[model samples]
Each structure stands twice: as structure tokens, then as C-alpha cells.
Target: MTVAATEPRVVAARRRVPRGSARRHIIAAATELFARRGYEATSVQEIVAAAEVTKGALYHWFGSKSELLTSIYRELLAEQTARLRDIAEGPGPVQERLRAAALDVVAHTADHVDELTVWARSAHLLDDEQAEATRRERRAYHDLFRDLVREGQDAGVVRTDVSATVITHMFLSALGNTHTWFRPDGPLTFAEVGEQLVALFVGGLRP
Candidate 1:
């Protein structure tokens, strides 16, 4: 039997493009502009010009500016969620798995500083429903990481004094805030920064 090929990515009512380049270009342009110019300050016209696509084309892939912004974050969140799920559920010593999960999330955030910065700065502007949806998705990722911590706690590798909930949020808060001060050209490379952050996280979990 022949296997079926995966369907292509389509956004905004499935408008077709020249091999999906239109969607790719719009997302890329919007991410850069939203990161550089505040999302509110970045106009659709500017995005169109930067993307070299028409306003209609932009709208074809995104229903509204908010939708575009959400897409940027949702995609990144989806990618992170996949990685987190793998690390959380994959077989290993609970302590090692917990450490790996913390390191992975921080590293992922550091890698996507620009796009994540755009979302962090502009997510408040999203409409209530969209904002809630994003939060739900983000919360799911948080819960996945927390589950690993809970596993370690149950196994006595992690301290029972701190709630797994608090521990998870504490590490995640730092990981999410890396964009505020981290600089690629700074004395410490992002990898070094992530290492230090992970060390602090794992240290706190010690029994």
C-alpha cells in the first residue's frame, strides 16, 4: 500500500500561492517588522512592501493584524510544545529528564529571542479570545514541564518544600524573560547564559 503525502500549509481560508512562498514571506516579514518596530507601529502596508507582496496577499494568509501576530507566536509555541512533550514523556531518570527539560526550554527561548520578543511585547494587544487561546496553549506547555518536575518530586529527587507549580513557573519565568537583557554579543554567549540558568533551576530542585 502507498502512503499518503502530507497536506501543504494553508492559512486564511486556504488561499493558494506560488508554492506557499506568499505565506512564508508574509510570516517572515511580519516577524522581523514586529520585532523591530513595535507590532502596533508596524503597518500592514510596511509588511507588504517588506514582503514584496500585495496587501491582498497579506490578508489572504492572515485575517487581521492580530491573527498575524498570533500565528507568529502560535507557531513558535507549537514547536516548543513538541520538544517539551518529548523531553517530559520520553524515558529517563526523572532527575535527568527534569534537568533536560529545563535546559531545552531555555535554549529554545534563547534561539527565538527575536520572534518571542515580538510576542512578549505585543501579545497584550491581541483580542480577548485570541489572547485566551494563546494563554491556553502556553499553559499547556507549562503544564507539560511541570509534570516532569512533579515526577521528580514524587521520586524524591526534587525537594518537596517547593511546589512543583512554583518551581515550574520560577524557571519558566526566567526562561521567558531572557529576551529582555540577553545579547548575542554580550560577554556570555547565549549557550553559556542558558547553562547558568539551567544550573540555577536544577540546583533549586535538589532535595
Candidate 2:
């Protein structure tokens, strides 16, 4: 579709463009368009117009559409990973740390559901290098989270019957898919939903 046709729906609801940051605007515009129209349907030209930036500016920030998509995921993952690291290393009992980590990730995902949703839908379209890089970073996050579970298991608080790998995957898969069913206007807010999910996750870990 033409930029004019798509701009209204895509740009109207996006976060306000930051001053002197064409990169953020382009990323924001691309994310909205990708989430609403699917990756394959959004074109470079359309994103430029919607972002109100030149093609040169977009290309300067992102090498290509694939890079932009990967950047979106990387940026979110980086923030989440940093938060997880802090929680994992902070002074707390294993169970408490794990619970806090779980709650934090869910809240972060809920807060950025739109961007995560875009990544979920379009990650497969990324080039091999981009895909592998993201996978590696994601794996690091999972490993850190699994170590927390292992810590709990070793402490004899979390169940030993279930493997840490299995527990981690189950909880994360559920959290990762939250964007699929969650709605801001729904009867229960994501915060409420996240608390319940975290409870279920921590409860399942109990021996």
C-alpha cells in the first residue's frame, strides 16, 4: 500500500517521534507497520514516509529491513537480559529471586507487547546472521534463567523431578506467548495476569 494509505493507521497510534532521532521514529514506524500488516507486506518506502524520515536516514540506522527487524528484537532482548541479570545476581533467596525475575520479564513483555509481537511474527524473515545472533542472545537469557531454576532445585525448594531445562522452557514459552492473548482493554490487566502466571510458575517449582 502507498505510504499515505498506510500512514494514518500505523503512525497515528505510535509513540510520539522523539526530537532529532530519526532512527527511533523509523524503528517505531516499522514496528507498527510490521505488527499490523505483517513483515512481508510493509515496504521500505512506506516506512520512510510514515517515520517522516528520508530513505538515507533509515538506511543509515538499519542496513536493511531484516536488520531493522533484528534490531527491534535485540533491543528488547538486551533490556530484558540486563534486568534478568540484575535480579539473578542480587541478594535474595533463590525462590524470591526467581519469582522476581519471572514477574519482571512478564511486566517488561506486557509493556512492550507491540514490539515483541512484531518480532514474534517476523523473526523468521531475518537473514541467517541476524537470526543466529538473536538466537544466541536469547539462549544466553534462557541459560541464566535456567541457572536460577537450578539454584532453586539445588536448594531443595524447587522440585527435582522436573528438569530445569523443561521447567524453564515451559514457563518462558507461556510468558513469551502472552502477547498472543493479552489485551489492554481486557477484563484483567496483564499485571494481574502476570502475577497469577508467576504464582503458577513458582508454585510448580516447589518440591
Candidate 3:
């Protein structure tokens, strides 16, 4: 029998993570610094100082700066993935689920746009192992979404002429790139944008 591939790669945290405010401080500090200054420009020393935590505390929470960055993005993705699973599995028509999923993701990203922007800009700096793991997790998320599209197509609600892959990427691309042009102070609110995008998505899928 062929051996299965290795387990998913996760940036392992140091054992004996103590409960305290230090860990929260380190993450908050790192996120703010990384957003203000590019990831490569930010240093561990700066993070610890800004957090007002000792180097020992930061190290205990995260092994390295890159690991910290990876963990940040991973945490966001984990939340999105969990929410997607719930909407996908819950009772609803396929189109309704798709609309809800799309809107939910757009809203979540808008809420965390700063952290999302940091990841988008610095994700390339991550180590190969951590990066590959994230890619796998993301692919799983995409596959779950694609499955929803396929279900719609099978139900005769979504057009079958367009491939599910195309539909999936088309809508996801629009929603995923919101950080590029979205502005909180801009005329258009995120809720407004989300509603319009959902309308376009659902309309395009109609057979």
C-alpha cells in the first residue's frame, strides 16, 4: 500500500503557553507594526517593546516573526473556513447559501482589512512549509465553495453552460480583492458593495 502524504504543516507553537495578557499584547503590537511598516521592516525587538512584553514572552507565544505572521493569517482563514462550513452544511437553497457565503466573507474581510492587507503584501516572505500549508487550507476552502456552485448547477438554478470552476473563481476574485479599493470613509459602504456583489453573483448564475 502506498503511504499517505504527510500531515498538514502548521507552525507549531511553543509548549506550555501560559494564559496571560502578554500573548494578546504581542499579537496586537505585531499586527499594528506590520501594518504601519512592512513586515520585513518590522523587527522582533520592536514588537516586544511595543507590546511591553519581554522577549521571553513573545518567543513563548511565537517562534519567529514569520511564524507570527503566518499564524495571524491562519487564524483569519480558520474563522472564515468554519463559517463557510456552517453555511454550506446548514439548511438552505444552494443559491441562498452561496450568496450568504459570499457576503459573509466580504464582510469579514472588510472588518479585518488591515490584517488582510498585511498578509497579502508579506505572504511571499513566509517559509515554504508554512506557505504550502496555508495554500492547502485555502484550496480546501475554495473546493468547498466550488461544491456549492456545482450543487446549484445540479439543481438547475445555476447555469450549467459556465463551468463551476469559472463561476467559483470569478466571484471569489471579486470578493477577495476588496482590500485593493475598499475604503471605510468612501461613499460606498461595505454592506452596499456586498449587496451589489451578491446580486451580480446570483444573477450571473441564473440559468
Best by TM-score: 1
Which 10 residues in a row give candidate 3 its minimum summed lDDT? 12-21
**Model 2, stretches more than 4 Å misplaced?**
1-19, 183-185
Query: Which residue pairs come into collision in candidate 2?
Result: none
Give the per-residue lDDT of model 3 (tens digit) for 1-207.
Answer: 999899888997544324588887888889999999989999999998888878888889899999999988899999999999999998978889988888888888778778888998899888899999999988888999999889988998989999999999998788777767888799998768877888898889889
Give the per-residue lDDT of model 2 (tens digit) for 42-83: 999999989988788889888989898889889999999999
Instruction: State the TM-score for model 2.
Output: 0.87
- Pairs of residues clashing in candidate 1: none
Residue 63 accuracy (lDDT) in model 3: 92
Question: Candidate 3's error at 125, in angstroms?
Answer: 1.3
Whole-model lDDT per candidate: 0.87, 0.89, 0.87
Each prediction's RMSD to truth = 11.7, 8.9, 14.7
Is candidate 2 or 3 superior in lDDT?
2
Residue-pair clashes per prediction, in order, are 0, 0, 0
Deviation (Å) of 157 in candidate 2: 1.4
Worst 10 contiguous positions by lDDT, candidate 2? 7-16
Compose the digit string of candidate 1's lDDT tens values, residues 15-87: 3446559889888889999888889999998998888778898898899989999998999999999998988
